[model samples]
Target: MQITPVTPDLAAKSLPVIADAFANAAHSDGHEADLVTALRHSSDYRPEYDAVAVNDEEAVLGHAMLSKAAVVADDGQRWPVYVLAPVAVTPAEQKKGLGTALVMYLETMAYGDGIRALSVLGDPAYYGRFGFVPARPFGITAPYEVADENFMVRELQEGGLTGVHGVLHYDPAFGLTPQA
Candidate 1:
């Protein structure tokens, strides 16, 4: 399988692939596909950070996105961060490392762009393999109540979160109100 940024053609094909992937997921909220649509229209959207995994035939089989975000400290300080959400892989395409390939690709892209940190609300068991750890210990908290284990963070570079800490503020496109 090949991994590449979501071009217009890939985007067109990946939307349904993404929607259907989530629709078949037992853990989805059924709104992840819609969230992707809204996020694309938001100011924080980064087209280059939206990526897909394709087959030899160039059929998109999975999708992943990283959007701009921040963490606000009690002193009103805001630190830039990236939020990884709604990674989707067609059921038939899962378990073959397609999702991991997409995520790892995003990680390389984010680091190349000098992004210091990434946060995600996902299964710790799955993300842990990528070095994700509970964000709470790093002084980061999710906007909504979430299991500490599921709300995770990873530093792209050394000391990326050495002193970073605060309530996470996801892009408004996520339909989540930022908490001060």
Candidate 2:
């Protein structure tokens, strides 16, 4: 599988396919489509964060994105961060490591571009292999009540998230319940 940055035109077409993959992956989890839609329309959606993996024939088989994210420090400062969301591999392509390849490729791209920290809502089992740990380790929390393990962060630069503290504010597209 070959991974490449998504071009503007390709981003438009691949989004629906990515959404469908999210829907399928989240079928039993509920709120899959909502998450997918939020990521699609989030203000942070940029071509730089969008990527697709294609086979030798150029058929898209996997997709993923990274977006602007922030955490409010205890001192009332906002620290810039990045969020990875809606990573999906075609159902037929699942278990062949395509998803992992896409993620590694995107993270490498982000690192090369100087993005230092990233967070995501995903299974710890898989993400841990990529060096993602609970955001709490960096004084970060998700807006919603999530299993601490499911909300993870990774630092591309050593100590990237160190000393950063605040509730993680994902781009508005995440559709999280408002805090009462």
Candidate 3:
């Protein structure tokens, strides 16, 4: 499988792949596809961070996106961060590493873009293999109540999360009303 950036024309095609992949997931909240749609139109959206894993036939087998986010320190300081969400792979494509490949590829792009860290709400067992660890220890917290283990973060560089501590804030598209 080949991992490639999802260009504008390919964005629509990725929707179904994402929907289908999350449709039957035991832990899915059922709005992952919709979240992707909202994020696409949000001001923080970055097309380069949207990607897909394609098979020999060029069919989208998996998808992932990293978008703009922030961590607000108690002193009201804001530090930019990246949030990975809605990563999906068709059920048939699971266990073949397509999802992992897509995520790793996106990480390289984000790292190149100078992003300090990446965060995701996912199974620790699955994401840990990629070096993701609980964000709390790094002084980061999710906007909503989440299992500490499921909210993971990876520092793209040494000291990436250093001095960056606070409640995490995601894009408005995440369906959370921004605190005034």
Candidate 4:
């Protein structure tokens, strides 16, 4: 399987697959696909961080993305960052590591882009495998009240989070509100 950026053609074919995958997810709120769509149109969306997993035939197997976000300190300070949202793998392709591959590819891109750290709100066990840890310990917190385990962050660079502590604010697309 090859992981590649979500080009227009790939996105046209992959969105439905991504929607179905999340629709069937055990923890989905039935709106993850919508979130991806909204993020795609977001000004903060970085196409380079959006990706798809495809087979030898270029059939879409999975989809994932990182979006612009920030860590805001109480003193009115903000540290820009990225947040990994809605990593989806078709149910039929689940357990074959397509999701992991998608995530790894995104992370590799983020690191290359010089991103200091990134956060994700998801299954701790699954994300932990990628070296994610509770954000609280790093002085980072989610804008919403999520479980300590579900809201996690990973430092991509050495001492990336050092002295960078604040509430994580995701792009408005993540809020799931209709864009004005």
Candidate 5:
């Protein structure tokens, strides 16, 4: 399978398949639709931030997204970062390392583009293979309640998350309503 940046037309065409994969993967999770919607609207949803793995026949087998993220600095500046979310592989494609290939490709692309850090709420067991670890080590916290082990970050640059702290602010597309 080849991992490639998703073109606009291909992205649109693959939405239904990606959504179905996400829903099935996230079964019983209250945020599947919200997550899908957020992914569609996020600034990072561009062709550059999204990718798909296609088979020799060019059929999309997996999808991944990396979006804008921020870490608050001691002086109150928001240090730019990236958030990886809702990575999905077709059920039939699971356990074949397609997800790993997709993520590794995206992470390398992100680093080449100057993205220093990446955060995700995902299984550490899977992501740890890619150097992701609990974000708390770098003083990072999720905007919503999440299992500490599930909220993880990886620094692409040396000491990328060093001394970084505060709540991670995702792009507004995450569907979090502000208090009145």
Candidate 6:
């Protein structure tokens, strides 16, 4: 399968695939597809940060989006971050390495573009394979209450998070309210 950025045509075909991908996941909220659609239209959406894996017949097999996020320091500083959410692969394609390829591709794109860091709320075992480590140890907090181990972050380059620290917030489309 070939991984490519999501185009209008590819997007139209991938929505259902995305929903199907998460259908059986115990962690699914049943709105991942909607979340993706909302994210695509949100200000956080970046063409370079999203991609689709397609087959030889040009059918979309999986999808992922690395969209904009921020870490708000107590000093009122906002540091840029990218959040990897709702990575989806058709049930049939799961465990075939398509997800890994899509993630690596997006990471490569981010690193090439000089992004400093990225975050994701996922299983440690799954994301750790890509070098993700718990963010709490690094002073990064999620906007809402999530288990510390569930929210992870990774530096794209050496010293990427050197001076960055605080609460990481997702785009409004994620439907999460910051802790008051």
For this target, which candidate reaches the highest lDDT against the unseen true structure? 1
Q: Kindly list the per-residue Cα lDDT of model 6 for residues 40-131, writing each as its tens digit.
A: 89965797677999999999999999878889898988888899988999998799899999999999999999998989999999999999
TM-score of 4: 0.94
Per-residue accuracy of model 2 over 86-158 as CA lDDT, tens digit each: 7887787889898898889889989998887989888999999999999886778888888999999999999
Candidate 1 segments exceeding 4 Å error: none
TM-score of candidate 3 to 2 decimals = 0.95
Candidates ranked, most accurate by TM-score first: 6, 1, 3, 4, 5, 2
Each model's lDDT comes to 0.89, 0.77, 0.87, 0.86, 0.77, 0.89
Q: Per-residue CA lDDT of candidate 1, range 1-180, in tens?
A: 788888889988888888888886777888887888888888768899999988899998999999899999989899999999889998887898888989999999999999989999989999999999999999899989899999999999999998998999988888887822
Lowest summed lDDT over 10 consecutive residues: which window, candidate 5? 171-180
Clashes of 3: 0
Global lDDT of model 2: 0.77
**TM-score, structure 6 vs. true:** 0.96
lDDT of 5 by residue, 119-149 (tens): 9888889999999999986788887888899
- Where does model 6 exceed 4 Å of error? none
The C-alpha local distance difference test score for the whole of candidate 5 amounts to: 0.77
Q: TM per model?
A: 0.95, 0.86, 0.95, 0.94, 0.87, 0.96
Residue-level error in angstroms, candidate 6, position 116? 0.5
**Model 5: pairs clashing at backbone N, Cα or C within 3 Å:** none
Indicate the worst ten consecutive residues by lDDT in candidate 6: 171-180
Q: In model 2, what are the clashing residue pairs, if there are any?
A: 38-173
